[model samples]
Target: MPAEPPVDPMTDRELRADARRNREQVLATAQRLFAAQGLGIPLDEIARRAGVGPGTVHRHFPTKQALYLAVAIDQIRRLVDEGEALAATDDPAALFTLLSRMMASGAENAAVKSALTAAEFDLRDAAPDAAAGLTHQVARLLDRARQAGVVRDDVTVDEVMAIVAGAFAAIRHAGADTSPERSAHLARIILDGLRPPSRR
Candidate 1:
């Protein structure tokens, strides 16, 4: 039998460096394309924008679903980090307002908005780590608010999520008249429901 070719020894550092560059390029291109043309933009455009061949893009992403998953995971990680930073605020009202604004901005991003919708389909199966991290951060913030009597003890984290999701939906569903003031007003109403009962 013919001898099999010897396998080459892989350098972990080199492999990691290459993968890092590819991932960065893909993400940057995808962000720009999605921002300009929404989530329906073609993958070929993303490859061209990245200055990478379609084959290279496929080698990294394999499919549109994979690319969307990667983008969703990245956005979720960023949101978790932002949530952690916001969690440090002492004022609950300000914290909720900041979070609401962040959610509104995220809704404006076509890729993120799509991902948020897709997230409902398989939230447990897809991006579990990102989802868990976000959930933990949100729970922490809610707990802090509850302990301080700024947020209602009866409100669950799920309820807050629903409020944000509804706000995003409303903004998208309303064509030209979707003002930030309207979003803020709706957020205030939601927050009112989350407020703790007065000690008096």
Candidate 2:
């Protein structure tokens, strides 16, 4: 009998590219369905919408918590990216506008919002590498904004996360008709409080 060849693990670059495509497709479909219905939609439905099989979904996400974690992490990465992109704009209002828009859009996606909330409940620390990278990126943008006199020095990253968590709670309680405009308005109000007091 001939010996069977051992299967090899995917190369890092190939794995990353595959994961990126799968993640993007899952998020896009999940966002559309969740926005239309809510987070209560079945995982099977999400898989179907994404044109993937249930087994494939499970392979990517062993449980709802895993799926939620993936979504929350992706969202955080996106926000951090957007923040960094706007960090050098030299326009406080523009930066604020971009932040507000992101917050509003975030409020509408029930799956992503629920995932963020679940992440809070899980409270397991992020993996060291991911945590460090996200912290560095977010902190860099925040420090720049504070130095530019746009964001208040007293507003810590923890406080910003708290506000985001609260916003998700508000949306969940309010239901699908929850207005993104209202969430944006509320986020602006919260951000206003985080702004440094005017030097008299």
Candidate 3:
């Protein structure tokens, strides 16, 4: 008897394209809502906003925590994708632009910040492999910027990460009345700090 081509369980149970799309939509909507609102949002509301059925949402994410972890993982994957796209440009300025954009967007995104700061969630545990990939992509971006003579050669990835973390912390503290200009100004300052020291 044929061994049936050694059926791959993972592949066999792969989600249909529609199901995948619905899942992505759910995650994106959830991230947006969670950022604007908080993690207290109901799954039904998320499904409603995503234009999907509650069962569809539950089928993809069995619980609120599962949904949260999925959202975090998706966010990390997006950063990884953006880093790869920018790295291909080999432009230090573009890298800075990406960093600035991240800081600006991070200002409004509580869910993303929570993934990094919340001890209860432990994103590392939720998506260890994706977490490692995000770190690698970020390091690559910094290395490229350093080699381009745009960013200070002495600056380590850890230092850049620290600066980014500080920016997010500031964003968290910012009042609702805070203007967008404030975030852009802070991003510019951070970018300036990363540049090589001026010659006399």
Candidate 4:
């Protein structure tokens, strides 16, 4: 029998890289679709928009619930990244920048979040590491802000979380999920409450 050709290590690495790219594209497309049209969008449609085969999406996310959770987790992980980047800065008010991003990110992915909530899924349970990392980042920033007297010393990381949750609720209650301007306005009002009282 003729000897089989040896597999190229570079080829395997290239294939893996291509798969990663495809997965990222699918995730981004599904996130945009779910945000714009809700979770009713078909997996096939997401693959189509992502320029990948249907099997690609199915291989990565077997069902709508899986996709929803992945999207939610991805959103949080990105926020954690942003928070980490902000923490490296000298700006004490970087806390506001990170919190602002968290608010905006949650609002943008509200539809996916609603679906996960309906399914009784919490990111803290589904993705413990990323969830805890996000909280830790927030805590670090909060501590720095407090030390700088930019934010109220009385506020704990837990309270900051509750306030963000409340802000999201308020935004949804006002039917402002589709309106970035309105959502931002509401978020500002709630975040403003975090500022320390004037010494004057």
Q: Which candidate number has the best TM-score?
A: 4
lDDT for residue 42 in candidate 3, whole number 0-100: 98
Model 3 residue 146 CA deviation in Å: 1.4
Q: Report, for every candidate in turn, its global Cα lDDT versus the true structure.
A: 0.69, 0.64, 0.75, 0.83
Which lDDT tens digits does candidate 2 get at residues 1-200?
99988876888899889877886898777667767786578889899989878887788888765775666656656665766676657655444554564466568665445444444443226434444544455566666777888777787866765666676555556562367666766677656766778821
lDDT of 1 by residue, 22-49 (tens): 7789987887676566668778888888
Where does model 1 exceed 4 Å of error? Answer: 1-12, 88-98, 176-200
> Tens digits of per-residue lDDT for model 4 on 1-200?
99999977678789899999998998898889988888788999999999999999999999988988888888878888988999999999898888887777778885334422333477667888977898899999999999999998899998897777677778889998889899988888888899987821
Candidates sorted by TM-score, best first = 4, 3, 1, 2
Query: TM-score of every model?
Result: 0.77, 0.68, 0.80, 0.90
Give me candidate 2's TM-score against the actual structure: 0.68
What TM-score would candidate 3 get against the native?
Answer: 0.80
Candidate 1: worst-modelled 10 consecutive residues by lDDT: 115-124
The TM-score between candidate 4 and the true structure equals 0.90
lDDT of 4 at 187: 86
Q: Flag clash pairs in model 4.
A: none
lDDT of 3 by residue, 43-162 (tens): 999999999999999998999988987877787678778877887885766667667756665665665555655544656677888767766777888877777788888988767766
